[model samples]
Target: MSTVTNQAVGKVTRTRGSRAWRPYLYHIIVGLLSLLMIYPILWMAASSLKPNSEIFTQAYTLIPSKLEWNNYVSGWKGIGGISFATYYKNSFIIVIFATIGSVLSSALVAYGFARIKFFGSAFWFGCVMMTLMLPHDVTIIPQYIMFAKLQWLSSFKPLIVPFFFGVPFFIFLIMQFIRTIPHELDEAAKMDGCSKYGIFFRIILPLIVPALVTATIFSFYWRWEDFFNAVLYLNKAQMYPVSLALKMFLDGESISNWGGMFAMATLSLVPVILVFLIFQKYIVEGISTSGLKG
Candidate 1:
C-alpha cells in the first residue's frame, strides 16, 4: 500500500512539473513572435539614426556606428520652402476635426437607433449597414465632381465635411455598446422629465465613453494616415499632410534623402503609438462589452 501511495505521489509530481514548464514555453514562443512582428519598426528607428552611406551597407544592424542627428534636422527643413511643421499642423487639423465630427455624430445616431424606435428606423438602419458594403473607390469620382462643383478642392473642407454625417462603423459600435446599458435608466430619466436629447447627453453618452474613446482612436488614426484623399484634393505644398509629404522625400531627378525620410517616418509613428498606448484599454473593453447585452 505504501509503495502504491509513493508511486501515485511521484506521478502527481511529474504532472505538476510538466504544467509549470508549459507557460514558460508559451511565453517564449509569444515573445519570439512579437519580436518578429516589431522587427521592421525597430529597424526603421535604428536606420533613422545611421548615416546615409551606412544605412544600406549595414542594413541588418540595429545599432548605428555613428548617430546622424542631422537626418532629423534636414527632414524637419522639408522639401522646398515648406517645413514639416506645416504638414504636421495640416494632419492634426484634419484628424482632430474629423475625429470630433465622427465620434459625436456616430454616438448621436447610435443613441437614436438603440433607444428611440421610429417609423422606418429598421429600414434606415439597414441602409446604413449596407453602406458598409460599398467601397470608397465606387463613390470617389462622384464625390470629387460634387466637391469640384462646390469649389471645395485644394482645401480641407472635402476631408472634414463628409465625416460630420456619422461614420457607419462608429455608429454601429456605439449602438451595440448603448444596447448593453439597462433600458430602465432611460425610463427613469424619462420619468424625471428628461427629453430624448437629455437622455442621450446625460445617460447614454457617459456610459458609452469606452466605445467613444475606441471610435475616436480609430478616427484619429485613419484621418492622420489618409494619403489618397489628401493627394487628390491638396495641391499646395503648404497644405500637404505628413502622409503625402513623406512621398516628397523621394525625388526622381535627384538622390533620395533616405536618412531624412527614415527619421521623419520614425517621428510620424510617435503620435500613433502614444494614442494607442494611452487608449488601448478602452478598445479592448469597448469591443468585449459591446456585444454582451445586459
Candidate 2:
C-alpha cells in the first residue's frame, strides 16, 4: 500500500510540474514580447541624449558618446514664441477639470442606471449604449458647429465642459462595476434612514474608488494627449497644450529637429508613465473584481 501510494504521489507531482512549465513558457514568451514593445521607447530615450549630428550618423549608436542634458532645458524653453511652461499649465488645467467632471458625472449616471428603476430607464440605458457604438468622427462636425455657435473656440471650454455630461464608455464601465455591489447594501442603507444621495455618497462611492481611479487615469491621459481637437479649436499658440506645442518643433518648410523632438517627446511621456505606475494596482483590481456581482 505504501509503495502504491508513493507511485501515485510521484505521478501527481510530475503532472503538476508539467502544468507549471506551460505557464512559465508563456511567461517567457510574454516577457520577450514586452521587451520588443519597449525597445522603441528605450531607443527614443537614448537618442534624446545624442546630439543632432549623432541622431542620423551612419555609425548610429544606441548609447550617446556625449550626453546633452541641456537639450531638456532648451526644449522646455520651446521654439521662439511658445513656451513649454504655458503648454504644461494648459494641459494641467484641462486634464484636472476634465478628469473630475468625467469621473463624477459618469459615476452619478452609472448609479442611476445600475440601481434605479424608473420610466424609460431601459430606453435611456439603450441610448447610452448606442452612443458608445457610434463613432466620434461621425459627430465631430456637428459638435464643432455647436461649439462654434457657442463661441467656445480658441478656449479650454471645449475640452472641459463636455466632460460634465457623462462619457458613454466610462458610464458603461462604472455601471457594470456598480451592478456588482449587492442590492442588500442599498436596502441596508435605506433601513438606516439614508436617502438615495446619502447612500450613494456614503456607501457606493467608497466601494468604487478603484473604478474612479481607473476612470481618472484614462481621462487624464486622453485630455493630455488630445491634439486634433486642440488644433481645430485653439488658434493661439500660447493656449496650446503640450501635445500641440510639440508640433512647433517641426520646421514644416525644412527638416525637423529630430533630437529636440525626441527629447520633448520623452519628457511628455514621463508624467503619464509615472501616473500609470502609481495607480496600476487600482486599475487591475477594479477590472478584475468589477464583474463579480456580490
Candidate 3:
C-alpha cells in the first residue's frame, strides 16, 4: 500500500509541475500582446521628447539621443498665443456639466423605467432602447439642422445641452442595476411616510452609487474625446477644447509641429487616466451588477 501511494504522489507532482508552466506561458503571451498593442502609444510618447526634425527620422527608435523638453512649452503656448490652458479649461467645463447632466438625468429616467408605474411606460422604455441600436450618424445631419435652426451654432450649447436628456446606454446600465436592488427598501421608505422624491433621494440613490459613477466615467470620457462635434460647432479657436485644440498642431503642410503635438497628446490623456484609476473599482462593480439582473 505504501509503494502504491508513493507512485500516485509522484504522478500527481509531475502533473502539477507540467501544468505550472502553462500559466507562465499564458502570462508571457498576454504580456507580449499587451506590449504590442500599446507600443504605438509608447513610441509616440518617446518621439515627443525628440526634436521635431528627428520625429520621423527616429520613428522606429524607442529612445532619443536628445530630450527636447521645450516641446511641452511650445505646445502649451500654441498657435495665436491663446495657450493650451484655455483649451484645457474649456474641456473641463464642458465635461463637468455634461457628465453631471448625463448621470443625473439618466438616473431619473432609469428610476422611472425600473420602479415607477405609469401608462405607456413600457412603450416609452422600448423607444428608448430602440435608440441604442440606432446609429449616431443617422441622426447627425438632422440634429445639425435642428441645432442650426436653434441658433446654437458656434457655441458650447450644442455639445452640453443634449446631455440634459438621458443617454440611452446610461439609462440602460442604471436601470438594470436599479432592478437588482430590493424593492423592499422603497416600500420601507414609504412606510416611514417617505414621498417618491424622498425614497429616491434617501434610499435608491444611495444604493446606486456604483452605477452613477460608471455613467459619470463614460460621460466624461466621451465628452473629453469629442473632437468631431467640437470642431463642427466651435469655429473660433478661443472656444476650442483640448480635443479640437490638438488639431491645431497639424496643418497638413510644412508648418505642423509633430513633436509638440505628440507631447500635448500625451498630456491630454492624464485626466482620463487618473479618473479611471480612481473609479475603476466602481466601474467594474456597476458593469457586473448591471449584468447580474438580466
CA-lDDT, candidates in order? 0.95, 0.88, 0.93
In terms of TM-score, how similar is model 2 to the real structure?
0.89
TM-scores for every predicted model: 0.97, 0.89, 0.96
Q: Candidate 1 — worst ten consecutive residues by lDDT sum?
A: 285-294
Question: What's the lDDT for candidate 2?
Answer: 0.88
Model 2 poorest ten-residue lDDT run: 52-61
What does candidate 2's lDDT look like per residue over 67-166, in tens digits? 9887787788787766788888998999999999999999999999899889999899999899878987998999999999999998999989999999
Q: If ranked by TM-score, best first, what sequence of candidates would result? A: 1, 3, 2
**Residue 5's C-alpha lDDT in candidate 3?**
100
Cα displacement (angstroms), candidate 2, residue 69, comes to: 1.7
What does the lDDT read for residue 91 in candidate 2?
89
In model 2, the runs with Cα more than 4 Å from the true position are 1-27, 58-60
What ranking of all candidate models by lDDT puts the best one first? 1, 3, 2
Candidate 3: what lDDT? 0.93
Q: What lDDT score is found at residue 209 in candidate 1? A: 95
The regions of model 1 sitting more than 4 angstroms off are: none
Candidate 2 residue pairs in backbone clash? none
